[model samples]
Target chain A: MNDTDLNDLLHTAGRTDGTDSFDARADLARGRRALARIRRRRVAGGVLGLAVAGVIGTTAVREYAGDDTPTARQEQQSSSGVEAVRLVSQPLDAGSYRFGKVPDGWSVQGENAFRVTIAKDGDPDTHPDSFIGKLVIMLDSNAPAGDEVTHHNGREFWVNSDGGGDHTSISTLTRDGEPAGTILVQFPNDAGWAKLTMLEFLDSVEVLEGAQPSVG
Target chain B: MRATDRDAEFVEFVAEHRPVLMQAARLLTAGDHAQAEDLVQTTLTKLYVQWPKVRRSDNPVGYARRSLTHVFIDEGRRAFRSRERVVAEPPAPDARREEQVADDHELRASVLDALGGLPPRQRAAVVLRHWFDLDVDQTARILNCSTGTVKSQTAKALRHLRASLEPAVTLKEIP
Candidate 1:
């Protein structure tokens, strides 16, 4: 805590000879492999976000402090059909979850406090639009396989006419010890699994209280 | 040197500094050994790609630290789990594993717990100040903050850490 203690801890972080004097060859080589894993993250490629006319930009939003708060940095682009959508993304503030147990290629995304954003294997970009969009929304309320939250008379309804696939969505959503939502999705068959994933991610959006939806 | 030669040089650089980078990765990750190692490797890999330009920096070490943070953020694009942090122990005067490591383990656990209690910025400040021995300015560079911000963060971090440790220490009477 004191300078001395902090100094002592810093000293203990490593051996004396300085980091440049280290065997950087192996470290750099390993870095390449890790690069492959991180190359397509949300950083470099904004991905299919702008494509979905109904996109959630980080734009200015209602700010209020609470147990879980979101900071919006609104960004926008033109789409064929633009619908006002608000996005509230919080970092891993509380604590991130462990993925060593989850299936390979699956990741946890969105709210860091407690969340699970699943995308089909080998599909990185546009997942939120195709399947991930739909999944997150469906998780809030279970819909039969191939169902989308269709608004009928101001009520959100989960309906799937085509009998898409075995939709079993699994996620844990919590705020102040209360379950915000939960899901266990299974596709009827693997036919539209990939599409389902994208739609799920896109539709499965979490907007803050009173987020404006822009319509064009 | 040629591009290939430069790439080789960068690789050599990372091979050695892997452990130090691992230390940074270890803190960012919380305590995941494998992930820390992976992060170290990834940090070095980018340096290798831009070796020529990166090596030109007046501070190559700073370059590597920045690279590591970038890799961390990028990786979290998918998701990021914290790594386990290690608390260093002083060697016992006598050579006894049981007597030495037991307290060392307890002390290390307390230190990590204390670190977890701090906010992310404070944790980074404490880790940079104490673990890496970077001065306020250098730590600011690593954290991408002003030196004064680093100083305040260090102060706040120390306050929290001390508060966490005070209960364990007893006042000694000098007779």
Candidate 2:
């Protein structure tokens, strides 16, 4: 066929001028719900995965220690300085460690050799000026020894709170009394909610087997 | 801005563009109305997810069109069309103008059949080039291929269509 023939055929083919039957109100509502479901599923999957990993890690430790009782681990938590309660967990894949617990909506925003920062996933394009503060978790593996030691559910963690800015807390965690991982938690200024979340996250800190010292 | 306002704006956009997009999808799917509707829905859902980015773009319509093409391409790549399907026969030609109408219906069916017979990429290239009147460079950008690829694919597709259609009826009779 020549150009004219092709054009005529295509014009007839593409002529969908008034054939649309989309229900915008219904579709938009459905789309919004779908997006919400997707986000929820992601969060749920992350939570479930981390929780399972925690239980498996704890079970292995208990089995290695020859502890038979279910409350054996719970008893250990009471002896530690920090209180233990359940929360959602996360793995900063690069750090070779995971957050034992984190507040909802605090997804990993950035990561590097020195740190992995978690913050609310703000709508930057739409809400450019909206203030959504950060909670940074830094990794410092260069130091040979830790200055302070804190215990949580029988796990020893080295505590170093930076007095300089917004109370940045660097806790070097250990598993089986060895340097398992290091983390630095930074709270935003005037962020009382973040401060509370940071404290809770620190209390739930448990070192996993994968802490390698490399900048991401 | 509040999220509701953004949602409303997006809804407005969908209402305005859905007809044309559905038409394009219908053409792309070889006049399969049901598949075309599904394609448009899928495209619109994607657009909804990226509405903020789309709203900020200089050419939202072009972006949506490109997205629709990509969606169609991806689904075609997945080989989902291998599932069994049955296309119903078209209605009989009108009795009053039986001969002319039957000829016309036969021509339309043959045109659609030829278009559908092409491989997905070749079909997409042909539709974007001829149906949308996009230049080789524009079609290349949308198809995420080189201009050379677009030219070759369009040429091949046209050759195939000509082979199927020329002797019996020119493609222009498709109405």
- Candidate 1 scores a C-alpha RMSD against the true structure in Å of 18.5
The per-residue C-alpha lDDT of model 2 at residue A172 equals: 44
Off-target runs (Cα >4 Å) in candidate 1 are: A1-4, A13-216, B1-3, B70-102, B169-175
Off by over 4 Å in 2: A1-4, A16-20, A45-216, B80-107, B171-175
Query: Once model 1 is optimally superposed onto the true structure by TM-score, how far is the C-alpha of residue B32 displaced, in angstroms?
Result: 3.1
Quote the lDDT for A126 in model 2. 26
Alpha carbon deviation, residue B158, candidate 1 (Å): 1.2
Candidate 2 local Cα displacement, residue A29, angstroms: 2.6
Writing each residue's lDDT as its tens digit, candidate 1 over B1-175 gives 4746766776666555666787777665544456666777666666665455456555577777767765664565456434444437653343353243235444455455566566666766766676666677667655644578878877777777777644452112211
lDDT per residue (tens digit) for residues A32-133 in model 2: 876687668768977886877766556446634656576754532422232222235553353443666665554666544434556554524222111124
Q: What is the TM-score of each candidate against the true structure?
A: 0.43, 0.51
* Predicted complexes: DockQ each: 0.13, 0.17
**What is the lDDT for A80 in model 2?**
29
lDDT of 2 by residue, B1-175 (tens): 4689779988888888888787678667766777778788878877676566466555678868887887787777766352222447544444532344234445455566677777778888888877678788778756744568888888888888877665554444322
